[model samples]
Target: MTQPAQVPDATHRSVDVPGGRIHLVEQGTGPLVLLVHGFPESWYSWRHQLPVLAAAGFRAVAIDVRGYGRSSKPRDIEAYRMLAHVADNVGVVRALGEETAVVVGHDWGSTIAANTALLRPDVFTAVGLLSVPYAPRNGFRPTDAFAMMGGPEEFYVSYFQRPGRAEAEIERDVRGWLAGFYGVLSGDAVPPADGGDPHFVPPGGKLSDRFPDASLPSWLGEADLDVYAHEFERTGLTGALNRYRNMDRDWEDLAAWDGAPITQPSLFIGGALDASTTWLADAIKAYPTTLPGLVSSHILDGCGHWVQQERADEVNRLLTDWLRSLPGRARP
Candidate 1:
């Protein structure tokens, strides 16, 4: 894998939102493209995309989503609910002096970006989803589905529901935990088919127990690990973990839009080996009705969960090409 390029002329700033401040790193100048990251990661996750998007003639800004990095972490669990995140994105665009923007996200952020476009199409003109496909809210409660997913062993999402349960496991060894988690989900160190699944925690066992013993992926370096570890180490995991704690709340909050489709122009890219893509293959197939405006869809063979990082050059070309293809873009 190619080493990440040092972003040229990157600038850092913070914007005040409803209840707290959001920290972001921005590069380039032109039509705004907001990059939102997923769990256990910060704005730095988009380090590879910043310079490329900037050079492509679009202002690329990646933010530390609320409860991660330097962003304000609300004390109440409800504060981390889905609507709060959507509100934060709206604040970000208005704060940046733009009327509308194209939003892209990965993992949990993918769901967030989809909801943002679905809820406020006027502000988010376009959307891009990486790693996870868009699945409209379903009939069943999220927790109920997750509970049934694990016949006996606790699904990782279910394990994260209780307050301080996963936090205790992660805070014990942030660096090692992060390295192990990133390793198992990455293309290079993905768990074997017969191996115990990392997504399901054995009774009384931690998720790290399933993490394979291995070196970091070629796409991730020691320095990169440090950036992630230091942030979680300083901030603690409560704010981040609270995201999982609010899944049931999100279900209740978004009941109005159940089965709704994101009608804005959209893009999707996922790793072939990623469970997010494999488990949700139906969602990808349903894109015709669910994501009718999707411009393109791709599954990068041999890649894993971290799509943009593991395959930076390929993802960059795809992103730039798709962004340039968007109708009515004044720049590029």
Candidate 2:
């Protein structure tokens, strides 16, 4: 897991959107490739991809996704709904002076990217999803499905519905919490099998209580941890957690696209050990229907939740190969 060389020409700027501004870091100069990150993470999560994509002869851009990093944080929880995120992605492309571009994401961003491609296919011609698979909107309420997942304990999503519940637990020690959370999810270290499930919170218990106290993941360094902890330390966890509280709203908002499939060129990469892959195996199996335009799908052996970071070289190769394979996006 050798780290990629630092990209020297990378630059940062903000683009004006309806609600506020989006802060992004970009490099290279070819076809536009917009990258959206997921929960508890920022553009920094794509540090490895930005350089690789740029060197592959394409312009690569990664954003802070509104609630994380330097992006604007709207006060209302409803503002973080799925439609709002889709709008932000649209605004980013328009603000960048491009008519259309490629959009890729991981974790929650995977859903956001899929919706963006679904709602505005004209603007995002191609899509790539990592860590999480694309599952179209369904008739059932999201909260109801999550509730049934945990028999006695509360699912993590349900636990996050209350505004200040998870905040209090995480804010108590941002650094330690981030470390434990990241460590337990990486393939290098997993939550003990004997211990209770990390996805469910015991009655009257905290999520971090199940986190591993082991060292950081192989790809994450002390400086990297500081970068994440510093942002949350200054901004608090309200903005980030707001995304989880809007599950039902997204389900309701995206009703029009119910059972819709992304028809644009698509790629999906997942970590074999990641719960996201194991839990949603059906989604991948249904890719033939849900992701009709999917070009390829790979589940990296021994990898974990952090697909891009944990296996930077392999992810970069897959992303670049897929991008080049797109019609007219190929480099010499």
Return the number of clashes found in candidate 2: 0
Residue-level lDDT for 21 in candidate 1:
94
Model 2, span 1-332: residue lDDT tens? 22222347898888998878998999998999999998888888999999899999999999989888788999999999988999999999999999999999999998889999999998999999999999888889989999998889999999999999999999999999999888888888766554888888888888877888677889999989987888888788999999999999999988888899999999999999999999999999999999989999999999999999999999999999999999989987
TM-score of each: 0.97, 0.97
Regions of model 1 farther than 4 Å from truth = 1-6, 190-194, 330-332
Model 1 Cα lDDT, one tens digit per residue, 79-122: 99999999999999999999999999999999899999999999
Kindly report the root-mean-square deviation of model 2 from the true structure over all alpha carbons: 3.1
Cα displacement (Å) at residue 45, model 2: 0.2
**In lDDT terms, which candidate is top?**
1
Worst 10 residues of 2 by lDDT: 1-10
Query: Distance (Å) between predicted and true CA of 128, model 2?
Result: 0.2
